[model samples]
Target: MLHLVTGHAGFIGFHTACRLLERGDGVIGLDNLNDYYDPALKQARLAALQALATRTGGFYRDVRANLADAAAVDAVFAQHRIERVINLAAQAGVRYSLQNPRAYVESNISGFVNLLEACRHHGVGHLSYASTSSVYGASTALPYSEHVAADHPLQFYAATKRANELMAHAYSHLYRLPTTGLRFFTVYGPWGRPDMAPFLFTRAILEGRPIQLFNHGRHSRDFTYVGDIVEGVLRASDRPAAPDPAWTSAAPDPARSNAPWRVYNLGASAPVALVDFIDALEAAIGKPAIRELAPLQPGDVPDTAADTTGLQADVGYAPATPLREGVQRFVDWYRGFYKV
Candidate 1:
């Protein structure tokens, strides 16, 4: 399979691309390598991918370009015979959206449309894109299900991602495109984003700095490991979406449609409190954290628990890693990578 993966230098994207390459698939990786967090980390991930491709004898091409550029996207499609598209690119960070709204509109909305247009024109077989558990915003439901209506988004970032689902659905309906939107829960692991809690907490603990606990350590999250997430992505990519035979217009399922479109929540299906997760980190690192409890920030949810039954039923998606084991792996990687 020839796969085109946007944001291929990103945490999940890099891992996903590597997995595909290891299986002897040709991978075209597109990433702008922006300095949103640190471009150096992105570069390092790309270097690792290059090394993996060399070692595995798998064809890999690293394309440095922004997804917002229509010409660039169109050119890539014209150049390569792309069979599938795994779009992991977007202006991520919920708080960042509050500060810079245009970034989300440009990357998440406009850039997404460009990809959709290219996919429609290029005859791509299947398009699997990343969504977020944050899309379940404003819904006080525990164990968020794919079947529930996710109409309300708490933040602009979540709103943009929700918009992506709607946009994908429209394209799928109008052009008969096969699209699958994977609503990933709080993901963490080695090479994780520095902006996330795991990385922040680990770094702070290692440096003897104070780690901020939002919502007074009361909020919980379904923190899925990156490896598990990549597994689900691969499985979903292998299966092109088909119209749900049981779908009906009268009681339209939010996750499925009569068109070739579907949505699935990908997570560990286990919620761990912030303080307990910190405890896991402390155990993994053999050090205690200097905690600074703070009130919940704007656009932050109290908890997120994924009801992954839909994903498991559709793609046999099962998250295999335990939280402690995953955190330990991450801590080990952090120490080794940073020479801490």
Candidate 2:
């Protein structure tokens, strides 16, 4: 199968594209190589993909283009025999969104609209896109379920992701496009974004700096591994969404629709405390972190737990990596990559 993977140089996109190439799927990767975190790291990921493709004798062509450009997206669709699309490109960061809300609008909203338009016109078979767990914003619910209403988004980033879900649903309903949205929960592992907790904590700990614990170490997150995330993503992409026979408008489930569209939580289903996660990182690095407990930042949720039953039932998605093991793997890669 020929796969069109946006943001192929990103952490999750790199891993997914590598796996697809390893499995003999030809991949055309699209990425702008934006300096959201570090363009060097993104370049390194792209280089690694090229090396992997050469070794495997599989096709991995990368096109440097922004998803916000409608003509660029359309050009790629017109050029390639694209069977499926994995939309992972976005301006990804809750705090960053506060500083530059326009970036979110341009990338997450406008960019997603361009991709949807290309998919609609190109007759793509399955459209799988990345949605964040942050969409379950300000909810006091313990285990976030897909069926629950997600109308309340705390941050602009979350709002844009939620808007993507709605837009995808519209495309699916209007054009019979098979669309699947995977709400990722606290994804972390090697090659992660520097803005994220795991990478920040690891860097601070290694450099003998104090690590800030938001909400005074009271917050909890699902902390899913990237490998597990890629697995779930691949499975979800393979299974084209279908209309739910049980769906009804009277008591509508937000996760599924009468059209060929669905949303599922891709998470570990186990919430780990912020302090515990820090301890795991410390253990992995063989160093103790200097902690500075702080109040929770605005647009930040206190806790998050995923109800992955819907994903499990639909696509056999089960996150199998343990927190300690996953943290160890990340620490190993971080040390090797940074030469720390």
Candidate 3:
């Protein structure tokens, strides 16, 4: 199969692309390579993809373009025989969204619409896109379920992600497009986002700096490992969404629709305390972290736990990586990559 992977130079995208290539699929990667964290890291990921492609004899081509550009997206569809699409490109930080809401609007909203248009026009079979656990905003519910209503988004980032789900549903309903949105929970592992907690904590601990514990170490998260995330994504992509036969408009479930659209949580289903996660990192690095407990930042959720039962039932998805092992793998990669 030929796969079109947006944000291919990104953390998850890079891993996903490599997995696809390894499975003997031709992949075309698209990314603007914006300096959201470090352009060097993005470049390194791209280089690694190229090397792997050369070694495996699997075609891997990357196009430098923004998803917001309709012409660019259309051109790619027109040029390649793209069978499936994995849309991972977006302005990705919750705090960053608070600072610049426009970026979220441009990339997450406008860019997603462009991708939908291209998919509808082209003969794309399955369109799998990244949604966020942030969409479960302001809901005090533990073990957030896909059937629950997510109308109250606390941050602009969550709002945009919710908007994407709505937009994809519309496309699926109108065009019979097979679209699946995966609501990813606190994803972390090697090559993780630099802005995320795992990377920040690892860097601070290695450099002998204090690690800030938000909400004074009271927060909890379902930290899904990146490898598990990539595996779930691939499984979901292979299984194109189908309209639920039991779906009824009178009592509609938010997770499934009468159209060929669905949403599932990709998470570990086990929420770990912030301090415990930090301790795992410290153990991985063999160094104790200088603690700096601080007040919770705005647009941040105090806790998140994923109800992945639906994902498991549908795709047999199960996250198998233990937190300690995942943290150790990340620490090893960080040390090797940064020479710390």
TM-score of each: 0.99, 0.99, 0.99
Query: Which pairs, if any, clash in model 2?
Result: none
Model 3 clashing-pair count: 0
Say what the RMSD of model 3 is: 0.6
- TM match of model 1 to true structure: 0.99
Report, for every candidate in turn, its global Cα lDDT versus the true structure: 0.95, 0.95, 0.95
**Native-referenced Cα lDDT, model 1:** 0.95
Can you write out model 3's per-residue Cα lDDT over 88-155, one digit (the tens) per residue? 99999999988899999999999999999999999799999999999999998999999999989889
lDDT of 3: 0.95
RMSD of each: 0.6, 0.6, 0.6
Better lDDT candidate (1, 2): 1
Off by over 4 Å in 3: none
Worst 10 residues of 2 by lDDT: 310-319
Residue 45's lDDT in candidate 1: 93
Model 2 spans > 4 angstroms off: none
